[model samples]
Target: MRRVLALAACASATVYFEETFDSGIGERWQTSEWKDPMGAWVWTSGEWYTNEAKAKGMQASEDMRFHAISAKLDAPASTVDKELVVQFTVKHEKKDYAFCGGGYIKLLPGEVDPKAFGGDTPYAIMFGPDLCGYDISRIHVIFENKGENLLKSDEIKLDYSDKDEFTHLYTLHLKPDGSYEVFFDQKSKASGKLEDDWAFPSKEIKDPAISKPSDWVDTKRIPDPAAVKPEGYDDIPAEIPDPEAEQPEDWDAEEDGEWEPPMIDNPDYKGEWKAPMIDNPDYKGEWVHPMIPNADYAPDTYAKYPDLTTLGFELWTVNAGSIFDNILVTDDKAYADKMAADTWAIIKEGEKEAKDAWKKANKDDDDDDDADVDDDEEEEEEEELKDEL
Candidate 1:
């Protein structure tokens, strides 16, 4: 592909973080002993449907538990006038996966005690998909500012991938131009100016001096004074007996009693009537508040994060079995693309096939189980019949 070619062309871009979880989990990663302890992470391919050994990923091993882990980079990378790209893959493989948790990874600022990292620890950016029921299924892009975290204003809905339980890719590209692009499974999901999308303080505010005039009539329409309800409008009933009704010939007065015809919708009926509406003569158009330069808003280099020393995941999940793998934090988009193609794209089809095969195997087993149960029931019935005889 052209992306692979581009990657070869620009082979000089720096790679800040890369983890496949092949090994060195203890050597490279730090599991937090933060106040509530931490959930265990097992290197696994999940219970069903996998690409064999290739499917091995970092899986959250416990349900209803907190997980906090981080790995230190050999050299911390900074995003000063440089492009920063972060990408990772997640597989929610649990059959009954009901997520009330976070899978978003954090890019920790500078060097700090990795074990002490918790919910309170400051992070440069938190990015990934977070799902809780149907209402909240979105890839959160939150950034920290002055010890306070600011969540993105724009909602980046889920990619709505066909295979919800299969492994999917999430890629975030933060460029130097104050813009960002988020990709789901190599497909562009959301792209925009970071300033416009994130909860940054507005550059301008409503003019404090100006207020709406008291005489301004905002009501665009009003009931017409001349229009009136019909004199007998309220007197009409909604339904009446059919006028053409005749008693059935089979009906006997003593046996069937008096039979009445079913009521039909009344054609002459008129419901509660209101005066007709007309455009108000004194109506004024909707007023927009004039904006003035905000005195409080002072622009800064918000895009730059000088110290991105550690890559971490601090999460809490009700149903475990979310596998994370193929993480890459690099400056080169081309390289990241190539890496994704090499890892996710190639193995995805095989994974689906494997999943189907697993499902078929399980179904066959269930059928066998049902057959056994039927046989046992049949024997019991035969024994009962013999005793009766």
Candidate 2:
């Protein structure tokens, strides 16, 4: 029993990686080889008023192009554990609104060349928030298994409220039991089994051998044999001359065409008959296809990447102004929660206060400009009056 207990202790979770960006990105993080002529990633002291607090962080160059950056692990970390968690904070501080960009990170295999990374590079896992025009605002959770990269089939909706501008934490938890959960600002926004959410072959498929018979009485209604059409039903004309219509008295029948009143719909006319439906006595309920084991389907152990070597942010943005910081990749959930509470919870309040203050100052500046414009218009009016005199 003591030997088993010792083995269980050895398998517990540990914090294998972290990056707070307090000190510079250092030599560990490397920029990708794929470069956009228009833009690049830069390290700065945050954006807006938040810059005053944070000494160093990474953000896009605010140009309309792509940006890719990566950081490799000292050694590959094994993902064969029961649970794996990744957490990071991102701030979309584009004052005029963000158009399109990806705030996600990718977990690449050990064999990848950090310098040659691009969008086409293969990754073991890809997860985070992605935004486009008004329609698309979602958290993407993609996993690679057996050479096929499968995106989560179900929609992962995100809160696109006013709070999006502030720095918010995004967390993804993957378990060996084939379950996953996504958290926003440390709150669970979405959770589901991996197999059910991903676009993989169904574990059970309809039995192809069985099918509905040709003579199956699926219809609920039949023509009534006792009921007969009314006596004058066929004789009744669809249209008749209007009773209130009158012919013109000046009509000349010899030279001009004959004058007639416009036809009106016959009130007695009835539409085509349809038999009234009753409960279907011979109905075999709705025909359901019997499910059979899918020959090609295999259960995912959720341990696809036993060795995770590199983590990177390889994405494209149209109007770039997003800051990414405090990335943590660990097998321990407790450690991740603690880090978020300590770092994110503390600084978020200050960031919000500063953002609000900046907005108020801009409003005041605009009001003053309007006053100046009004005064100039009044002076021009006085000059026009003098010229008229």
TM-score of each: 0.75, 0.79
What are the lDDT scores of the predictions, listed in order? 0.77, 0.72
Separately for all candidates shown, the number of backbone clashes (residues 3 or more apart, or on different chains) is 0, 0
Q: For model 1, give the 10-residue run with minimal summed lDDT.
A: 1-10
What TM-score quantifies how close candidate 1 is to the native fold?
0.75
lDDT by residue (121-203, candidate 1, tens digit) is: 88999999887644467888888766678888868887334226678889999888778899988889889877687766668
**Predicted structure with the largest TM-score when compared to the true one:** 2
Residue 280 local lDDT, model 2 = 61
lDDT of 2 by residue, 1-389 (tens): 00111122234546556777876667777787676453577776554545544424678765567777787755465556457788888877762332677889998886878777878888998988887644577888888877888888877877546225678789998877777788988888888887788866679999899887776776665566556777767788889999899877887888668878899999987766555555666766666678999886765544357788888888777767787877877776777787787667765767767876665565666587785676578557545643553
What is the Å distance of residue 342 in model 1 from its true position?
2.5
At residue 55, what lDDT does model 1 achieve? 64
Q: After aligning candidate 1 to the native by TM-score, how far in Å is the CA of 210 from where it should be? A: 2.4
Error of 2 at 275 (Å): 4.7
Query: Model 2 Cα displacement at 181 (Å)?
Result: 1.2
Compute the lDDT for candidate 1: 0.77
